[model samples]
Target chain A: MSTKSTQIRLAARPVGEPQDSDFEFVTTELPALGDGQVLLRTVYLSLDPYMRGRMSAAKSYAKPVEVGDVMVGATVCEVVESRSPKRGVGDLVLAYTGWQTYAVAEAHHTRRLDPGAAPISTALGVLGMPGFTAYAGLLEIGRPQPGETVVVAAASGPVGSAVGQIAKVKGARAVGIAGGAEKCRALLEEFGFDAAVDHRSATFRDDLEAATPDGVDVYFENVGGPVSAAVVRRLNKFARVPVCGLVANYNATEAPPGPDRLPGFLGAILTLSLTVRGFIQDEFVPTRHDDFLREMAGWLRDGSVRYREDIVEGLEQTPDAFRGLLVGRNFGKLLVRVGEDLTRE
Target chain B: MSTKSTQIRLAARPVGEPQDSDFEFVTTELPALGDGQVLLRTVYLSLDPYMRGRMSAAKSYAKPVEVGDVMVGATVCEVVESRSPKRGVGDLVLAYTGWQTYAVAEAHHTRRLDPGAAPISTALGVLGMPGFTAYAGLLEIGRPQPGETVVVAAASGPVGSAVGQIAKVKGARAVGIAGGAEKCRALLEEFGFDAAVDHRSATFRDDLEAATPDGVDVYFENVGGPVSAAVVRRLNKFARVPVCGLVANYNATEAPPGPDRLPGFLGAILTLSLTVRGFIQDEFVPTRHDDFLREMAGWLRDGSVRYREDIVEGLEQTPDAFRGLLVGRNFGKLLVRVGEDLTRE
Candidate 1:
């Protein structure tokens, strides 16, 4: 096993879209594992839109990643050296080792992943934070009733796909909004969304209107921009918006210019009685984690839910892949294959 | 008794602030009372901020008052002539009589008021829609826990005052924001608010900062403008905003100028995990009305809650009184005395 670890750290905060100059690659000697700790080799590093927020000096639910600090993220890893009974060598586990090929993590901080039950990488995608965000935010805050229409953007991505499928499981009519025709097609074919609207099309507004003839009841807001503005107009009275992310605005350098729509939005809130709630998934883990693990596993087993992953080849592609994430360049749950999956070998 | 009702009708939609020309005084002859109907003499006509929305063609929770139609409003009335067994002549009751001296309404449409229990005028203010609005919106949506800080603007008005008092009743510290020093004084002294900030003062923001030592947990939003914007900045994580009104924007002719703030506000919702919920008081009538009546009656009886009123003389004064209501000229619940209260005599 290699005694040195190659890691990516934040070099400087980016102005808008993150660039290559924003990241610094470093090689460091791995410290000897302490008691109750495991030295893990990263097999997959999850790349998400929220990483964009962490890269900036912005006030968010989580603290911004400081310059020169290792970029924060969730990773699926293989424990290579174990000093605790909780984990053994060659055991695959879900860990938050960030953007590094190797990390010495406390054994209790990691959860064992059963490869036989499901693919180990599924622990970082459909069975992980993103999936739990869909489960808790939709069911707890959105509260979609039977026959109600639910609209979500970034429809081909992990959270959005899970939201649509779960909305279906709850007997709701799911409408997916994606940037391209291909993603929209996948929303209907692979994810089983009731309808899909291509937001990139010139007739997007009309398409959205036709798709949501009954009006939207639950809007699982993952991407915010003109698409969200259009969707807000189609919301029914007493509609619930569980805002989990705003990928479209994550790279914005300044506020958009125009006849300020804040007052107008507040007017709609008062007149239509809308509920707009923002949340971080961790807040729900204490209450809904067990339910999410059990129900999502059943859905995966029964084909009630399906997930797709877009895996890049190496750790060095982190910066570019993340930028692509904010712009919806890569579809599915974007991940970086930091090292070889030795278990599969 | 005169067989005519002199009313102020909507002449035309106002450009910004409502003007005298926008209202037309019309004297209409009353139709003969039919079975199950009563001739009601309007004693107190409530002039609220919502009336401004009714005068315009803007989309709102309720329909706008049509041009050439009598301006709609709630009123306390005396039954002058009855043809139904449900009500008797000289009984004090609550009715939707608009800005008129007399209205012929079905007896079943009016709720009989017991003058011995409370002042009959309160049936239109503290014990009416405004009171219920504060009750249901604050309790159901705001849900301020004990030891939390609750903030409200237009704190001298019926709804705002009731919201502050009720927050205190729930064991939360109440902070009030009002337009003038006198109103702020009333908020602290009369309404028993823990702290009061004068929005008209130059030190308004600083005062608000000092007032809410513990960040706001619940914001009962009745007035929306700079006051609300400032309060939002002071909100703690997971704060709740029960938006019941936006009186400041009711007369806005067009959307405000460049640098749209909607995105920033939504960003705040995301980062702080805030819940911004809008509601019409009537939605809670079925679920919370009985509890409100019982609790509010007890609070008033035991002096736990206190109310104030600003009564304008004559139905003809409604137009000016209503215009004043939009600008916070009236200090308390604004009402027009349309006719002499025969029961008081």
Candidate 2:
């Protein structure tokens, strides 16, 4: 049989909004699988805001993806052929195979997914890195106490959505901040938030103030811009800010123009005794990953935690979809449907 | 016998720098001590940076010093007349007697100080609250691992000086940042810091970079402004920042003008995965104070820790000395010598 695969590669780093030229799509022949390795066909590709950081050459907790390399991403795939004792002809698995149609990886690198447990796509969204990020960061660092208000920006995204829901489960009030009225409505209804404030509203500040009467105890910061500034003003003494991302300024090339509010922010921290912690999900994997898998699975099963996916068809649409993820264009957990799901009922 | 006592009271909230009219010095007669109380004559009054927060009507971790009230402060005092069996006449003790020369306090409110254990004035400086602040904040939150770099600003101040020394004791590289060459020199010679960078230098940023080659793992932030901004750039991955004070902008009335840099600061937090925790020393007193006292006493006994004092003379000069403390005029722990120590050897 003919061995062929389609792949997406980074063409150039985008300045602000990514353009079509920033990615190159190529169709090439797949290499033959070796001993103890499996040939997998991509089914679903996760497009996340973090991919923007990997595209830029800026120094970060993780190394940036080199130009011309396959854009790094997490994918749910179907094992087409296996050369090892772990026989998997049609078994679905999770892999970090980047933006490619097919990849040859060691069988041990892929974790087999039980199709009966949950949707294979759920492994890339709710039951994966983004969900676990919310679990570990909020529980371990944020520590939202009962009756306290927990505020999260980008509240419709996977990480923020899970954060708001988990805070509710912990007996805390969840106040979600999203871009528009629709997302805000989704946050309140779909995500089960106590209050949802539209950051895009002209009266957003007042809305946030009205939403959090007792003031915010834990602010799960993912979007740092005017939204974060407004939220910071309403924080109570000894508030905990677990910074997970800064999607608002991901494409920033220079420092924002300023009356220089750094001094004021620092002063607030000193006066209010705030705790601002920044973390990546991987840091908590060794300690809390197992707990996350069990708890998140249980939450999904019980309908306590809900997740939404905004799927874009085909691997060719991955680059444009990723750009939309950074600018808050695509709602929910942005994903690209790479290939047909043969196991779907 | 008739007793005349002079006291400083807050007359009005100062707009920027405090003026003479902002304080009212009154000579009052002291009443006789009650059954369980002692008449105290203030010897050394601690004039700290936190007093600035108290003077303002702005909300803080602590309540503001109301207008027409005696400005609060910590003091080392002598018991002139004791009606209680717990305290003897001529006993030296640490008290929260504000800016008054003489006052009556319950016996249990004061802790007796032995002149044999360092000095009576040490109760208000290196061996007291400021010292404990450095100890607990650095050890508990800062958590500097062995061989890692620990950077601290206000290198000559009691809290910062102790921070550098304690970090060194824990086998970490201590880098002190001070305003002038004299204080910087003292940081290395007296406090035993690995390196002391003069923040006033034209090439301060370069100096900081050269001093902390491995990047700062722990930054005990006491002075916030350009010094802190410089330190933030050198922070390593997962750096811990225990924000103790922001003396630089204590008098700020409004948010400074900006192409706002707060977003950028948050961006760095996300990329570096840093932990910035702000705290007041009182919060940790119940849990860690006893351990601090034991370990600090041992450090002082073995000469592993050293401290400096910038003592201003007399109770009448408190208002002017307090103004100096906020502007970093006082070199070490700013203390006002309120009364004569006639018992000193």
Candidate 3:
């Protein structure tokens, strides 16, 4: 049988901040599932800062979604019809179903998710890509040692919160920087971050300095802008910076006027003996993904780690929710609940 | 017996380009050598760009030259008198004696150099700190894979020359960047670099692009101004930037006018997944120095690596020779002939 899938397709390439004009809602008919294919209904659609990159034509680690294409994202879906033995109907699965409510994916392409183990939605957040990004980037690149200080921005979000928590797990002090007192409080109170500094505070620089007495040894870079610049200035000698995302500048139209400080930036890198490495999450999958799964799941189970899901009601809320993500409006792991999960409800 | 030692002391810290008035020359009396102590006559005094850092009071890996302190440097000296079993009268040695005609040091503090094995001046150039800077930083941090492209600036100088030649030894394509046609010629003819781009040339950017068609895999960053800016722009994904020095900005009094490109720089580090590491060569001593000595000696013997020296006639000419090094005036490894080597003649 077939199903109707409602998707948010790329309407136009964004100039700066993505607008309603940049996306178009479309309902398409899915053809009958072929052999070795599974018809899936997306229970939870992931909304991440990385989605902004897919919206633009800019060159990045991954290819941008072309105009007239479905906006891509990780989805926690329910298998509705299976044409292969690899998956069964009513089984929860993880799939790349983009911004759609339903998809026809090959059986091998979808991983079966056990509903008994935590929640299926986590495959898009803490137990999945975002968590793995924090894990692999922080440990492999940052390599924060005992008694060292790790600083991460966007601290209330999945990646930054995970980075802070992981640094603490490694015996390093975690300093979290967020946009407001509310988020900063959540960083320390909810995520158990060692310290939280409000990036929007009038005395943000002073607060950052006060938060990290020993200086930042590892800076898990998620938000890149003035916040990153201030943090980088306070980096200790031999500091490690793992550049995971630049959500701050995702909407920038052009480079700001400059005396061009790339030289001074390089000068600081030289004098301080800094290690600045940029990476995406997938690079460490072969070796680190399993460890991330086992560890993060344990941390969640034992109450050592906590997660918050900010779920918008429907597929239509995806764009606005994503726009909120770039501006630090989302409080935690942002997700769009496109349809009811039959496994739970 | 007592002897008179002529030394150059820092009269004051430099503001930008070091002035003659910033230095004071003095002839002081030295007492008779004690047990295990040696009185040495300076042979070759190494003049390097890192000295610019020492002339400033800024924080660095090593301490700065204090006002009224003898200007610190690496020196090749002849032992005029020794009161130890480790060395006898007339033995050549390497010592941190600074810019001076003579010094009194403990015999164990100096490493005796065999004049019969190689020219004693080599201990200050290709076989010393600069060469080791190239060796350790390039191998340990840069780690250029075979068939990859390795680019280094200051092409004819000790560090950059060794970096290019060693890159060739490791089966990578070595591209050299220098200031003038003469240095550019030496990069190809003397150092056997695959391509040489003159930084002073108007077509430098285009030339660099042509030279590095596969994109820069490793950039041995020594100079950090426009040359570095151009090189960094062409770096491939996962490029290794072992930032050994920033000779171009060593004398800058303030941050240049900015569109403040640090954010964009961080963005590139994120998008390209570049590995930018800064280091001082001394950190790798215990782990890699022995390997450097053995391997570099073999390469020099087989002519797989070649070196050149620009020797100034007298100690009084040291200041001019040093000033020349910062502006790419000297053709090769710069040295000052502080006192004649009787063994060589």
Clashes of each: 0, 12, 6
Order candidates by TM-score, high to low. 1, 3, 2
lDDT (tens digit, per residue) of candidate 3 on B1-345? 679999899999988888899989999998888999999999989999999999998888778889999999989998898899998888889999998899999999999898887788888878899889999999999998999999999988999999999999999999999988888998888889999999899999999999999999999999988898899899999999999889889889988886777777788888899999999988899999999999999999999999999999889998878888898899889989888878767
For model 3, the stretches where C-alpha displacement exceeds 4 angstroms are B31-35
- The candidate scoring highest on TM-score is 1
Residues B214-234, candidate 1, lDDT per residue (tens digit)?
Answer: 889999988898999999999
Give the winner by lDDT: 2 or 3: 3
Best by DockQ: 1
Order of models, best lDDT first: 1, 3, 2
**Interface CA RMSD of each prediction in angstroms:** 0.7, 1.3, 1.5
Local accuracy of candidate 3 as per-residue lDDT tens digits, A1-345: 558999899999998899999999999999998999999999999999988888888788889999999999988898889899989888898999899999999989988898899788888888999999999999999999999999999988999888999888899999999998899888888999999999889999999999998899999999988898899889999999999999988998887777777777787788899999999888899989999999999999888778888899899998898888889888889999999966667
Regions of candidate 2 where Cα sits further than 4 Å from its true position:
B31-35
Badly placed stretches (over 4 Å) of model 1 are B343-345
Q: List the DockQ of the predictions in order.
A: 0.87, 0.76, 0.75
Worst 10 residues of 2 chain A by lDDT: A1-10
Choose 1 or 3, whichever is better by lDDT.
1
RMSD of each: 1.1, 1.9, 1.6
Native interface contact recovery, model 1: 0.84
Tens digit of per-residue lDDT, candidate 2, span B1-345: 757788898999988888889999988998877899999999889989888889999878889999998889999999989999999999999999899999889999999998887788888877789998998899889998999999999889989999999999999999999888888899989999999999889999999999999999999999887888899999999999999998888877777777777877888888889999889999899999888878888999999998888888888888888888887777888888888987664
